[model samples]
Target: MKTNGKKTGSGRIAYRKRDRVAYLYLLPWLIGLVMLQFFPFFSSLYYSFTDYKVTGGMNWIGLDNYIRLFTKDADFHNSLKVTVLYTLYTVPLKLTMALAIAMFLNRDIKGINLIRTLYYIPSLFGGSVAIAVLWKLMFLDNGVINAMLTALHLPNIQFWGDHRYALKTICSLEIWQFGSSMVMFLAALKNVPKELYEAADIDGSGKIAKFIHVTLPQISPIIFFTLIMQTIQALQNFTSAFVITNGGPLKSTYVLGMMLYKEGFAYFNMGYASSISWVIFAMIVVVTLLLFRSSSAWVFYEDEEK
Candidate 1:
């Protein structure tokens, strides 16, 4: 009995030593989470409840900023409208284009890898300031697009200077960066079983029929993932509008992100900006929840089949 008790004690000591080593390994990550992610998260929440400024002290203000946002801020309303419009225009078009290209790339064709790489290059630089600046230059009144139109005896279009075309120009930029979604779709497409297609063919299923009945069902989960990710991305888009249009042309391209930036940095309304940030966070959470709720009806999992 004494020997057995000693053995058990030693085993527990060894287990504790192992646990200590594991905790040591996890220490850096825990530190980073608390310092970088969690601190900012809770700090923003606290800031939202105070009248914080960039260079001055803060006083407790409760829900005043949030109330002002809904009641008095016309710019907030306009920015929200523009953001919703941008998301509505950009997300579906981007996903559709990505899926179409993914389908094309899924075909067993020569030089397909090279073509895929070429197509994917735009996404690598899509969110960069340089690309936004380049896009701005390209859409200028006498820029390449307009010059080509002029050469073809077509009238010049003010892509950046005109409100009608400014937002659409930004949407086109977003759509052009569909490579990430395309690659994901391509991966999902390849996972679809060849036997399914063969069986469908035997059952007199045409190309469209096979796609609808087989390909779509197999890739629906990926589609759902891309939809949620792209929606979140579209809502948080700021770099292009800031670098390209500066939310100009009558603020037609002003998005919620830009509003957040202006309120936080430009105006030094940190408390109000914190409130906006929380609102954006809440919006994202609600949208994500809605997607998750709807996903059960559409998104198929391998485990579900079992």
Candidate 2:
């Protein structure tokens, strides 16, 4: 059939028409990308180079905000230390636990879907204010965790109260969201060939041996991807620290995100906050590139199957 002098699907015209319809359907997303994401990106770049405040006019200040952060700001140093520590600790622990749990559940088990749902429940509220506030209660002096310690005849630990363990409390909140990462790893693990494991078994490989020889190699790409992603997420983490600790115990848990918020919202220093955001963006980019550079040594693909 032809209309308005247009050709039919027998020609390349039909594919182009389908593409146009697909683009049309994607028009809303394109608009939102430009409006919500693209515009803010450029705006942030501009703001980072200026002396803009939340309630004041913008004045171009070049790299002064960046300079102040590195050289003149003690609090920036503190926040950076806390954030780096948090990221380092949380990422590996979460990934390891998640991978372990996912591998365990990957077997032939009844109600696996239900178990998955149960595991994933914490992820749904990982960043919610309500959950973080509730976390504050959970880490209190007489909370569930401490009560368990007491029952075990160990000293009741003060989690969020002390500078020593406040970071640990926040990490638990971060690690609890491992379900999302676990679900991804589970899917990737399932995609690993059963033939590979069978072959390993024929070679007299035990469970641990098969896991090291077949499973780790197959899942390395997913592991690397989640590592970079979770690092980025943890670097920009705000709500948990904000709600649970409020950067408490001498700002021992103050992440860069909290510093940005305090500078922009609390102190009306938008330019400094924007500068901080850009620094974070650059840090994430650098870390991601480093991981990508190192991935060729470890991350395996079937295309490069060896």
- Following a full C-alpha superposition, what root-mean-square deviation does model 1 have from the true structure? 4.7
TM-score of 2: 0.90
> What is the alpha-carbon lDDT for the whole of candidate 2?
0.90
Residue 182 of model 1: what lDDT? 95
**What is the lDDT of every predicted structure here?**
0.92, 0.90
- Please report, as a residue range, the 10-residue window in candidate 2 with the lowest summed lDDT: 2-11
TM-scores for candidates 1 onward, in order: 0.92, 0.90
The regions of model 2 sitting more than 4 angstroms off are 1-10, 13-23
lDDT of 1 by residue, 1-306 (tens): 332323366787876666678778999999999999999999999999999998899999999998999999998888888998999999999999999989988988999778889889999996899999899989999899999999999999999999999999999999999998998999999999999999998999999999899999899999999999999999999999999999988999989999999999999999999999998888889989999999998888878987
